[model samples]
Target: MIPELDGATWHKSTYSGNSGGCVERGILPTGRQAVRDTKDRERGALLFGPSAWQAFVNAVRDGEFGG
Candidate 1:
């Protein structure tokens, strides 16, 4: 089930440069991660289970998407 984001702490990457098109990520109470567009927060977010989120993060760190 998706967790509520009412009081979640969302933050964007420092490495996101000065672009206004970056996204934000927040940790839900259930330990899942929620991601949303920084510029369109009103649209809500995509919730990922802990393991799926970890795998995605690892892939990014490994440059799997080639930037």
Candidate 2:
């Protein structure tokens, strides 16, 4: 089934805690990744190219950004 182009496709991180601070991710029709703050949906999302998104994910997995 074709995914919805709207906000319906956005999803929260499985690792997100109960804390109010969180973000959602979505895959755009352009194959780019979109990230937006959960607290403010109208604020829009930050789009990332596939490679950039992969690099960011890899960095996170590698613990490049200290928790």
Candidate 3:
């Protein structure tokens, strides 16, 4: 079950900057992950479970998304 995850402390991606292409991430105490656009923190965030997040990271590392 997903836990209540408001108020999580978010961190910007290392690749993010003031150039307007930024992604912010936050890991909840429940191990879920949250992502949002750095330029609009007030907007809704996208949440992912730990397993899904890991899979996404692995895919990125494998260049599955065609970086």
Candidate 4:
């Protein structure tokens, strides 16, 4: 189960400036990663472990998400 999330400093992707489809991210105290919709920060967020987060970042760098 995801742990309690509070006081996390959420940051949005650099490419998400002024774009309607923007995603925000944050780092958890446990070194895990957190992601949420920039349009709705008060809602729920998706959590990812360090390894998973790294992999996703790499994938994005490789244009795996159809950048």
- List TM-scores for all candidates, in order: 0.81, 0.78, 0.75, 0.80
Winning model by TM-score: 1
lDDT of 3 by residue, 1-67 (tens): 2234475778889977678889988888877888888888677688889889998789878999874
What count of clashes does model 2 give?
A: 0
Quote the RMSD, in angstroms, for model 4: 2.2
- Residues 1-67, model 2: lDDT tens digits: 2233463468897777898879889887778888878888777777789999999889989999998
lDDT per residue as tens, model 1, 1-67: 3348876788996667775769899977778889988888788898889889999999989999886
- Looking at model 2, residue 33 earns an lDDT score of 88
Segments in model 2 whose C-alpha atoms lie over 4 Å from true places: 1-8
Local distance difference test scores for all models: 0.83, 0.79, 0.80, 0.81
Between candidates 1 and 4, which one is better according to TM-score? 1
lDDT for model 2, please: 0.79
How should the candidates be ordered by TM-score, best one leading?
A: 1, 4, 2, 3
User: For model 3, what is the alpha-carbon lDDT of residue 48?
Assistant: 85
* Positional deviation of residue 60's Cα in model 3 after best superposition, in angstroms: 2.1
Stretches of candidate 4 off by over 4 Å are: 1-3
The C-alpha local distance difference test score for the whole of candidate 4 amounts to 0.81
What clash count goes with each model? 0, 0, 0, 0
